[model samples]
Target: MRLSFPKLAHLDIRRGLMMVLWLQVAIAAVMIAGDWLGRNPPGAPSSVPGMSDPVAPGDQRRRFDPDRPVPRRDAPALPPGIDLPSTYPDRLTFERKTIEGFGDVLLLNGSIATGDADRLSSYLDGASTEDLPATVALSSPGGQVIEALAIGRMLREAGKNTAILPGMACMSACPYILASGEQRRVSPEGYVGMHQHYYDENLYMPAYFAVEEIQRGQGRTMEYLIDMGVDPGVMIYSLTTPPEDIYILLPEELLDSRLATEMLD
Candidate 1:
């Protein structure tokens, strides 16, 4: 006679499996919530991760809200002489504006969003030769970095020059567009800044994959900068700066890094 082992009850085995599945579901739900909160802080724009400064930030800084400041996400008032548009544009707006120094510039004002690049491209493609802008006048707090890169490349291919007027602030990804100019110009009081960028990632993606995505984005940005004739080494400022606060480049820094091909008096 052979000894036989007792079989576990099917109901008990099924219950154990159910418990494990429920536990996993609970864990995944918690992780997704946490990631959402981290990326979309209560006071910040849920879709935007902007670069700005409030009283020369150190470790903590307010997220840029070009439309208006939130109760908790406050940034410093614009410096003297700087002016926000009469009606702040929610999305990037490109309009022909005749300025004192830069003539017939496509005043690239308003907040840049994810789809702005395509809008710009479409507008340029449809414009007549007489209406095509030779200069892109930047006056933005900046928005999505990827879109900025795309816009910059388009500007480069079109052989457009970029400039920042005295009262305009070109913080965050706006500088990438500035770098694309064959003859970049920044006024003495123009605000051109940079900071770290945020890349979109799926909630359920592994940490390794997220890191890889970020690296790829950064690599593409660096490569784009080099292609635009700006030194990629200038990204050092971007890499070191916090995403919330912009690193205001010194006038000399702009000249030295070749980010500004020329200074506007």
Candidate 2:
């Protein structure tokens, strides 16, 4: 008979499996250590250093540094007397007063100084066509021709019935304003007159500088009066006549001169 080897009884299947698992764990730990060593070698800058870095207090950018403390921003102070201008009264002024009972009767008194255009326009801001039953109580020595014309045109367009009140006088460009009214009336003492318009020739310097701006002004006045529906002869006579002769024409004289539609009783 052939010699047969007896079956080996020294192998333990469970113990062999445990030994294999231990070997795999050891290999994984070694691989992880090697990878860590490769990535961060010796002599590299430490994330957690042994010595702390100092920051200077005067440095502007120190607050922005991640490792440093942040600084607070200071706010600016406001200026003094915020409402000072409102407290002070205006040095140059124009007065536009409304008279009671006269209903829309606006009194314009003072030397029609500069900036009257804006002031007058503002005064009449709320006025409407129907409110034209209102009258303008004018007592101006005179003012800018352009501004006066603007006021006259505005009144005419509003269809305001204008009458130079009994005691008030309309002089210079003011007369043109009266002519613009649908019905022009005057008080017993209310004088309506015009003289040559004058400008400070010195203000214009070289251009339009003339001693005879009066004549030029007269021509402009005549043109404006005609456009405002005043008789051409009335305008011509008013402009050419001396200052003393510019009184209201008598009813007979007005009719004879074809200036009046009907004489005032």
Best by TM-score: 1
User: How do the residues 147-172 of candidate 2 rate in per-residue lDDT, one tens digit apiece?
Assistant: 67667777777665555544344555
Off by over 4 Å in 1: 1-25, 32-88, 201-209
Q: After best superposition, candidate 2 residue 210: deviation in angstroms?
A: 2.1
Off by over 4 Å in 2: 1-104, 126-133, 199-208, 211-216, 241-265
Q: How do the residues 118-172 of candidate 1 rate in per-residue lDDT, one tens digit apiece?
A: 9999999889987877888887777788988999999999999999877567877
Model 2, position 201: C-alpha lDDT score: 27
- Candidate of highest lDDT: 1
| Residue pairs that clash (backbone atoms under 3 angstroms), model 2 | none
